[model samples]
Target chain A: MVFTETGTEIALHAGTSCSSGTCGAGIAQNPVQSLTPEDQRMLAAFRPETVEAAVKKTIETYKLFSYTDKILVACSGGKDSTVILHMLKKFGYAIEAITVNAHIGCYTDENLRNLREMCAKIDVKLHEISFRKEFGKSLCYIQSILKAKGYDYKNCHTCGVLRRYLLNKYSKPLHPDVIVTGHNLDDEAQAVMMNLFRGNLQVCARIGPKTGMVHDSKTDHNSATKKKFVQRVKPLYFVRESDVVKYSKLHNFPVYYGECPCSSDTYRREMKDMFKSFGEQRDEVKEHIIKSFISISEPLKAHFMQAEGGAIQECLICGEPSSKDICNTCALLAKLRDNKIIKS
Target chain B: MVFTETGTEIALHAGTSCSSGTCGAGIAQNPVQSLTPEDQRMLAAFRPETVEAAVKKTIETYKLFSYTDKILVACSGGKDSTVILHMLKKFGYAIEAITVNAHIGCYTDENLRNLREMCAKIDVKLHEISFRKEFGKSLCYIQSILKAKGYDYKNCHTCGVLRRYLLNKYSKPLHPDVIVTGHNLDDEAQAVMMNLFRGNLQVCARIGPKTGMVHDSKTDHNSATKKKFVQRVKPLYFVRESDVVKYSKLHNFPVYYGECPCSSDTYRREMKDMFKSFGEQRDEVKEHIIKSFISISEPLKAHFMQAEGGAIQECLICGEPSSKDICNTCALLAKLRDNKIIKS
Candidate 1:
């Protein structure tokens, strides 16, 4: 896959082929890419049995999902998501895949193609959504319009708000029991630290393997009021990012190794870098952080829930599940429309 | 003063003289040392009026102490402690000073001399204690003995345990209402992060401008049960370390700029460096962390106190205040005695 400098132009290219060149004619071939020395070292140290066991254990421990439940995997064509997808399929869980084509140049194009190929190979259904189709403009175009109109939001901020909105809106039709994402231990740890550093303790309460506010004893899980938002779970919550990469490489899974081209989230990046440097000195620092977070998550959730009155409201503008009268998506869209950056 | 490589030998010389060389003979002479370029820049940017107001505000807001209260300042001859001690004296708070001579080579020797000179200049009574006089050996000697006996404790650990024990024991006779330390914002932030990172939420609860577990609603502050440990407070709790350095340099306080020679607390050093780097990108990151910590500290302290039974115990051996049956100092001394490193 190739990306333009501005990430505004899409470049079409042939798909990656199996580099090992040893798959039989009848078998579904995977794109086996060359591994860097570091990748090779990690791959050598990767214990597939142990990693598989850990993933399964996390799923079981968290009661993430059952084999009978319909699981929708949020695939970004990244190593983490792709590994989880394949693992779930191999474990015989009824699953489907979904991807967002944010029109981020050739990046999303290649990711979407890889998603299609992997889903087809695994005999799972794939759902694709695009910003241009849904919002009448590519993500880059909307970002440019917002920038031209003096809105100073970062690319990741806009992308995250829109992508999350689309994921929830589009997945509602599928009626899956739970939506699964490929967030790993490192990602979860970063989220915990970022929320704390930003002084967003209430937000911190709404994160874990199963994301959301803690349910009070008074709230009924099966009540009609709780059905607006689909629950999200993470099976790979215990797996490290490096381990995911190593597992993906070991399995010759076609995945993108680079970060999002337009990602300018310096704070999160700094946190990631900090963890990397700290992890070098101490093994399982990320694990320690996540474990510590889990220990306090209950009280954190309870305190914040009580403080905020613990009600999930429907966005007045879009009727989506929100913590406020208007959801972040509807709010951002309103700003864009007010400035004539997007159609009303 | 100079510290040797092993930090086991003292090489003291004459005291620092005022570098500006403009002090009139009758005035108390301050050892005005040469400032680094960075220090000069900080000094130039230092707003003495604003800083003094902030310190005064923090004291009044926290009710740290009053003019009528007897304040015992923990003077280490470092920039932080020296500044706080001087500030308290200048503010007309009834204050005395105390120092712990750990005998960390020429480091403590120079600090001791500086402390004496500063106290004499300010007309505050000074009390001094030493490891050699109290424990029959210098700090280095004890650390060496522990190392030789395969105790594997870090120098900072041993020094901290012994120094804290000595401070509480020696300060008892002074009968001060509160013991004041020069803990700045950066130090408190680091302590918060370190405790959280180490999963010691209980320890984090025991820290703030006024350090201790939260007093339960039923417990009376005036009760004899709470009198075992002297209440410790920090007037410089909201001030940044850089500002403290600038304030110290601006006043030409005879303070040591370097860290302790025997310091090997890498975890804390890393936290400090992390804050420095983060501070470069975003101003007041430390303040944010500290403010957020304060918001949750009450719950943290209350929860931990309830879980731990909320009782301060008298050390079985030393009759000192401790959370455990035996104080850390008594336990360490026992270890040393058992190994024949110290007399029983």
Candidate 2:
């Protein structure tokens, strides 16, 4: 896990790499023989075996998944998602891949191409849900129309809400035991800091490696909609973004190494910058934040949950389990429809 | 507040200025006649009258002080402390001033002179505590010795610990209702951010406008040292550091404008810089952090306190109340003495 300014290149041990197909016949023959001595040294220090052990530790520590359970890897065709998918497949998890395409022009195309290519190589089925087919309009069209009508929000908010709604709605038939995301250490730390800064404790209570909607056959028996809420996990929770990038590149996954143009979360970007700067001085900055959050998470969750009052309601429009009468997705859609921006 | 890149000069309504003596006979006669229209507008937007109202509101909101209670202002001769002391005095509070002279070369002299002049002008009794006299060594001497021994700590840490120990020990005899320090919004926000970054929850739990030493008379029944612990308050907890500087200058309070030569809290400085940048975009940035912390402080305090467990012991060396057998002050002193650099 050697962090470099220009490029991130992690060196995994030959044994683990071989077992995981990270150093398959193709790469093993070529072996990024171009790595500098410095990079090689860094790679040796943070071997793949070490990173693999950490990933395993995180999974075990959080009880994120079971071997018998069906796992759905949420692939974005990005470095993080691709790396996670590759690792899980190599580790022999009963996993498949899903990509929710926002249909953001060339970016969407690139993502699809890369994702399809990678899935084909790994012999895994790739499932994709597009915004145009599901919502009758591309994310860009909806966002632009809203912007023209003076909507005070970035596209990311709308895209994220729709994507989450679509993921749950579309993945229902799969009956996955868990939904895995590519939320690495950097992303998780940024979220924790953001929630703390915004004084959003209720949201903070919901954050952890294995946190999301927990589907229980007995507890959720009264509400049919609650059954749609699947448990989500993150095997890459302890893995650094740098390590993910290095791993992805080293394995030659067809990853689109570009940021989303609609990444309007300026606050999150600032947090990432802070993490990067602090990480230069100490590598444990991200780990400290995550570990500390875990330590107090139970008490924090209990306190906030008690304050918020546990009352779940089904969204009137979508029949999704929500804290409010209308789910966030339904509320957002109502706003879009009111402005006559998003087509039905 | 109109955060400027070059300087921060706040405007005050003449009415409020007269009461606080900020517009003394000399300044009132001319009234910063050289201030440009832009500066005047900037000042008008962030007037002392408005700031005073906020201070009053915070006091009322937090129940920080009462008219019947005796208050001691911890004056550091800096802008923040000087402004606080002046405001409390003007508000007709039963207040006196205390200045701990760290005896850091010329810096100490400047602080003492300014404190003396301001106290004399305000007709308040000023108490002086010197590290050289009490600790048998100047803070500079102690810090230099510690540094020579490869002790990786900033001078501010040692200074802060010794100053706190002295303030509690000396102010104990006064038996004041509250000891107010000039920790403004910026300082408090920086501390909260630092604690979060450093993963220091126990320290974070001990933060807020009115937080410190909870004096339980029953718990201290058998321990004389425990009785010395006083409740510390910060009236300027909602006030920004820049505003304090402007208020100090406007009031013409004799204040040392120079930063301490040994002010080496790099992390704190970084946080300050971050605040300054964010403040330029949103003046309420500091307020936002403080408010957020306040919202979570109770639960956070409860969670951390339960984890820490309330266990207090008297220091073997100094007989002061401590979490361990040796108090922080004694521990620091022991480290300084270990190198055998301090004179007997």
Which candidate tops DockQ?
1
Pick by lDDT: which candidate is best? 1
Q: For model 2, how big is the iRMS in angstroms?
A: 2.2
TM-score computed on alpha carbons, candidate 2: 0.81
Which CAPRI level is candidate 2? Answer: acceptable
- Measured over all alpha carbons after superposition, the RMSD of each candidate to the real structure, in angstroms, is 6.3, 10.6
Q: What tens-digit string does per-residue lDDT give for candidate 1 at B143-181?
A: 766776778787877887777778988899889889999
- Candidate 1 Cα deviation (angstroms), residue B270: 0.7
Question: DockQ score for model 1, please?
Answer: 0.47
Model 1: residues with Cα > 4 Å off, grouped in runs = A1-41, A212-228, A281-283, A309-330, A339-344, B1-45, B212-228, B281-283, B305-331, B339-344
Residues A174-274, model 1: lDDT tens digits: 99889999999888888878877877665665567886322445434334534566888988888888788788889877666667667755578888877
- The TM-score, computed over Cα atoms with residue i paired to residue i, of candidate 1 is 0.83
Task: Give each prediction's DockQ, rounded to 2 decimals.
Answer: 0.47, 0.34
